[model samples]
Target chain A: MISARRAILVSARTLQRTKPLRFADPKKIRLREPIVPTHKNFDVSPDHPLWAFFRDGNKTETVLRSKDDLSTDSRPWDMPELRLKSFDDLHRLWYLNALERNRISTEAEVAKEIYNGDVSLFTKLDDNHLMTQKRIKQTLLERQVAYERAQLSSPEEYLQLFEDKYINADESAIAEYNEKLVRLQYAIFGIEPDLSEYNLEEDINVKFVEGLSYVAKLKLGRYLASNPGALELPLNGVMEELPFLVRDPEVAVEEVRAMREEGVSRKLDNIEVFAFLRNAIEAVRSEPEELAEEEN
Target chain B: MKSTSFKCTCIISQHSPGHVLACTSCSRICSLIQFHLFQIDSHLKFPNTNEINQNLKHTIPFYLTAEQSFSWLIQSTLSKCHVTSLLLFFSKLQTSLRPISITSTMSFKTAAKRGQFDLDRYVGNLRVKTYKEFAKHSRLPTIPAPIPTLRKDERLIGEAPIVAGDLAYIVSGKHKGKISRVLLYTRDNDTVLLNEVTKNVVIPKQYWAANQTSHVLEYPVPIPRKFVRLAAKEKDEKGNVSYVVAEDLVFKEKYYDDRLKRWVPRRFVKHHENIEIPWPSPMSEPKDDQYSTLTEDVYNKTHELQTVAKSPFPKSVLNELRNPYSKFKKRELTEGQARRLNAPQMPLSVEQKIYLAKKAQTPVKKLEPLSEEAKDLIGSRMAEHLAKIKNPLLLKHLEAVSQKTTPEFQRVLNEIEGKQD
Candidate 1:
């Protein structure tokens, strides 16, 4: 009456007579729970063939490592923070991210090979890392859109991206453009004169940090606010203290410009703010030629 | 007469006997041999035309006068051995053209680097850029990006072929006639990665390079889609899998589910129309172990669909939701704050509104007229335009018609039609 599948299954085992259950029942412990076998622990040493898979950032840690061990200092950058970061920083981050991704994937692949359907932690780790990768791109994309807008609003920034078109522009039109430019400068950067003429003591050596749009300058200001370390310079006070809302940016922009125009540039006693500002300005203004230098 | 023979380091174009242009981007950095055009009046040669006389020499510094693009022929001879020469024929792009007096402007070459000028630098630059891009692309991580097999390639998922998991037979290359799984498809290159036909590549260990450096990483090399064929994996009653050549498999755009919420691209055999070839699904979907996020919540579907599409752009995209782990980020807003700021309302307060309404009720009725001198100038320009009407009948009609417009409108007309090209 048995099916062929059952017959085949039965044929593989040795025939036996019915015996009394010594351990009460086969799988059941009537009165007490059964003892569980202890799991042996092992580490993937640097000597292992697939050790590269275990890398997190600087150190090679196992994917099974507890979440608490993850670097607390480092964080996935927000769009605003990313705006303040340099292209080189982003590019390097992207490259670093690819390595991180590869490491995670390699670990997942190896783990799957050893025990499939149990590398859920690696997958979770990957999901966590995936956001950071996406954020990098989001930051870049925001910059690209801003760059395009900046290109349209002002022909001055990366229109040197290809070739300089405004060099031979009509004198009268340029005069008119500069008049318009000064008004926009007042609105956006809070500089009274054109950014080129705004007599900040420090040389704005990199391309055009003074002319960064409201978004860029605001992030720089926010970055200064979230003081990793304070500013290097002796500031009059923090010129960018008030929190600027991205939705209504004009209010904050006007306030900064208004304060400066009234001869009251807020002084700040912060460390790396100016230093970070200088570095950020340099990063934002990086050209392809400058990128070549940065990559080296 | 030119005293010096400018035996340049650059290789002149074979098609056109002109200066060998440097890779315009790297030209500044790379210390290549130079050719000063003004230093030695290099004879501009076209493909078939003979060397021209003095008039053509005068035309050397010629400005492109017409609005239409004139193709400037230059040849890009790279230093690479056995490399086919890229003939650079760049049409004057409108974006590059500076709007100014042609007479007043200097020759474009004079303004550029003292090195050789090539208007066609853009064309050659693209190929070089593609090469550089490929170089970066080749150095990707050891692990392949997890692309779902039968999943329709959306903007979020990126571009993927309909027959993603099906067996692909190589039609060309060293792995010709070899059957392999179509591991990946890149829309940018229109190439497909074959799982079996792999190549050993050394991925750098860091951002500089990373992965399997000890034992060079084995990457599934992607070939152009043209050299691959979809061979559907079919099994007989015995359950032995055999790949059947599916040359006439037609891709049909159809709804995957009864709800019609999702559209999956599917293929069916042309010969046996009923035999639908479903793309082989990946072993498991890369889902989070945590909460399940609906597609509507994940994506901003408002752009693609006309309907509200389930509350487009979730709070995360709007910068109102903060990352759980981030302590440095200060982007999130409270529920009330988000609602208040995002609301569509006028900026003016009640006091300002009342003041504005009061001002509107009692408007300044006084109006000023243009001074006599200003009136004369405006009238004169309008008359001058009126004089240009050659036909006596039309001139009379225009003169009478001009009286209908204000002096400001006449000034605007003069401004529009006044500029001489």
Candidate 2:
């Protein structure tokens, strides 16, 4: 009676003994089954034989008609439903097919006979093959024209254009543009934009939004007002209780002023700020009656 | 008196026969008669007999006969005649026989009397008077003049005057060779302090870079030369002895065991020993010549190797044998043994376990499920594949044939999906 471990070892030894001594030729092998079904409903019997024949015949006729017509039609044959997807996906598929064909033939044959020498024809066929592709290119061109017109019309846009063109046009341009956008957003809102405002991932954005909302609640402000000597404590305590609120000087100053008006002016000392914030937050969180009693 | 001065004639015979006398008198008989008359006259003249006899009463009498008396009377008349002459004779004889006394008792007695006299009081009074006279003359008592006080700058004058040695302290340099004995004040320039005890030590003011005086080197005794040699020997002997002694007592006196008493040795001791060989013969070699005799020799050389050879089992066999007690050392497993060990056990998810069990039971060939559609599609493609495979021109077409049928291709796809999962 052999154990499982002994059996496995015996099998391994048998496999080693029976294995082939020479490597097999990969090119000589052939598959009896289909490689990958293109569609979930793929069948052996041709459902559109007449359409396939017309397409094949048209491709040949187009080749004889004009080199440009053949090249235009040489793009990957898209399924009718594929036109509804993004232009980028259609273009990716087209390039993938072209690469596959090129692997079978030389690049020269594909470029000369398939893509045709005319760049316009290639572009037109790709645009016609996918309606989304034509729409995207038109929108891009229109956006460029409109941007140019806007740059010419306003001094600010003109300045931005000048900076992009002469000052930081090459590698730093996008970074500079993003910095300016953030600055403009900060100026308009008087606060940094929350991560969710940019439609970031739910977990990350939610955490960021929650953190920002915690900052905006002025929980630290209320704590500072309630605790008279908390601001005099070390930064560690103040930072731990209300990490987000302590970072902003305006919020801190406003909170200090609120505490002062409430006759708890002594809490404004920087060292005691955390203790004050904690007390203020506690006061704000307590029941209304308790808070009123504390106020008194 | 000149009426008749009788010349005394006398036959005067002196005792000493060496004298002869010629008297200036009358003729011989007359001279004789004169001598007799002088004697009688001299006798009468010597003083009245009765009166002389009366005066000599305290003296002893001298008796003479009538003849001798008549002769005396005649001699007396002659003596009277030449008294000066007789007198001269008597004087000469007296001068010649006179006795001289050398010692004078009167002078010694006079000196004694003088010594016995009371002169001390007079002498003492004279001394007082002399002293008074001196005092009166000088107007002061005679005392040794107070050692004339020396001025601050004045040096006492005398032959080989005793000048104090320099008073000095080591100020700035090493040793500064501080000395108090100012040996020589040469040329009134510099003073040298002789460290006589130290010998060859002559320190000058320049040495100390200061001028000081009033110190003296007292109790200066030279160091004995023998002391230096004794010190050096002591140090050398002590050093060697110290090295041989215990570390803590290296600098202290040490004692060694003697016959009857503990005594420190003056020199180092050396010891030697003779080694004895127990086994003298070389070892015997093995019969097999392929092996070196040295290995066999070593095996026979040691008692350990001999003991090892006496054991029943070979060394390798002994090592390979498992200990019988090890079976009792097996650990018993507790419930939830995997949690205690922190080892991952077989996954317990029902679906995962079932799938794994199924995989374990299925045959490799039947692992992939066959769909009806896939089957139908494959059936149709089989004809095409067969046609393509037979045609030589279809070699190119065969190249397009996908590798779906190969187990390796399916395995690669499955691996990719597995990684993604």
Candidate 3:
């Protein structure tokens, strides 16, 4: 019913346009099921346009295969398996199932007339076939819901919401991050940086992350998100899916942007260096301890 | 995508407090559910849980990039993207010219992935659920737990000390130093069901069958963490592998496992040279006997793996959903990351060819009717860009962009003019 409505809606709109359907009705009317294959309801002609559908490659002996045999021939993709499939995969599978269903039902009717017996075996295969369609649709619905819930206009827009390397931050933010990172590396190695020029992309982004284990990269991304004025990707939206970047409760952006405007950027002439800031935080952290000791 | 179909009466200041978002639910459902195979509970827009925090707002405003800023041409998120709408719906807010409490949590600064909180309550809920399942599945002559629940202080936090498939050494009791596979673990009570450790249960008369003699059956017994220590295979300095008591098997502080993209509690074994033993990736269970799926294929995660489709859903969708997030929810085959994780095959089959033919024959889906908010956004954005152009003819496009320019456009224009002055 859903497919029919969607087809008709598309067909109605297509009628307005100049291009006609390639193999459908002359007026491009898409029938939900194949009507051209059937003959006055009961008998189907051998050479009908959709003859390939009614007969399963024109096989006859296998039509009466036992209930057990029929059940094994076709089965629905369950939730777990269906969930693994991509949208396009399911879209293809839906068509396959629809085509197979049409064939099986036609065969089932033919088998009843020829053998003068029940052809419920086709129904078994059809049931499983229908189940797969049901699950496929269910899976697609879930994806649509998830996409809507994420509130993404496009996937590109969502990349900004995460702190992924894919998200392109301004050169200023990256360069600023690079300076701090270079300082940290130098601090760790007990060496002094040139203090003048450093290319951010080369100074330890792609190469450094590529060398470090993935765990190290995550920790680094965490560090980037935690530090202010470092790498400011718009940390907006529901990050329920990608829990990679650890977010701070608040960011001191107004101050940082104000500083950026004041020309205290990458070179860090007036800004507090990593070591100095660490010392300041430590000093602030110890003040409460000292006061508590005094009270005691 | 057309954002909203019809002009909501809210445009007329219909609601109280002068600020209410139009029923985005109606518009969203219309587009989201493309199939009518199952009935969608329109009310079930957001998955509400008592422990889960719905408030995803940040404390500070953050600016999105110019490319990302172009999204208001279509849509914004709900609870998840609740904070994301700062820019997307800013035009709408300007038109309404109202301060909404719902948007108050729009703190864009912290991308707080703080998904679930109130851990204690959350844990309690999980335990209660597990207990119910255990009770339901328990058969006749069920063994009663000697100790029921642990005190809040005693209860283990983070990941349980023992999990299924872990080889645990019985430190004390009748089975002292006996190594066994831990089949199950109850976190609230430091109890583990060891495959080797079992208690003989006397068959009750109610459980006995006709002409059955009274006898005992052994069931895997739950051992306290105090009685069990994790055992691991360790190579001596001589380079021969042998089992040893995994010394100092303490959970290292929670770190995000980048491969898994979750804060997994990793256990460090001191005896094994402090090598981290990540939680064993749960083996994928074979599909039900009735599913007609190959047992090996299910175990190998090869079911329908070849039916690879270039996802219409974004790459970020894969990143977010993590290659079908539902599959990973059970941690099934985390180690299969390198096992053809990215399926490369999409040979257009006959069915697919037909699908494409039908798809082409079908008319393009109608664009959603642009909401008043969308017009406001495009107008405001265009105004900002057009303000720099001193051409008189091109300036008319700005006026024609929106029927009524949003207040934000006015502010942007004022800022531009002020800068010029």
Taken over the whole model, the C-alpha lDDT of each candidate is 0.44, 0.33, 0.47
Report the lDDT tens digits of candidate 1 across residue range B1-421: 2111111222121222221211122221112322211111122122211222222233322112221111111111111110111111111122333332121233222322234332234344564454455455443555443222221232224324434566888878788889888776666456687779887766554533333345466777667777887777778999999777655666577655433223566677778777777767653344433323344433422122111112222334334333455655547876777798896776999999999999999967653456799999999998898777789989778769857988777666565666433
C-alpha RMSD values across all candidates: 37.0, 79.3, 37.8
Error of 2 at B406 (Å): 89
Cα-based lDDT at residue B227, candidate 2: 18
Model 2 residue A200 distance off true place after TM-score fit, in angstroms? 7.7
What is the DockQ score, from 0 to 1, of model 2?
A: 0.00
Ranking by lDDT: 3, 1, 2
- In angstroms, the error of model 1 at A18 is 99
DockQ, all candidates in order = 0.01, 0.00, 0.01
Q: Score candidate 3 by TM-score against the native.
A: 0.25
DockQ of candidate 3 is: 0.01
Over the stretch A189-269, how does candidate 1's per-residue lDDT look in tens digits?
344342233334343312223443332343334334444333332223334432231212346445655666697665544
lDDT of each residue in B94-134, candidate 3, tens digit only = 34332232212422111121232223343456755655555
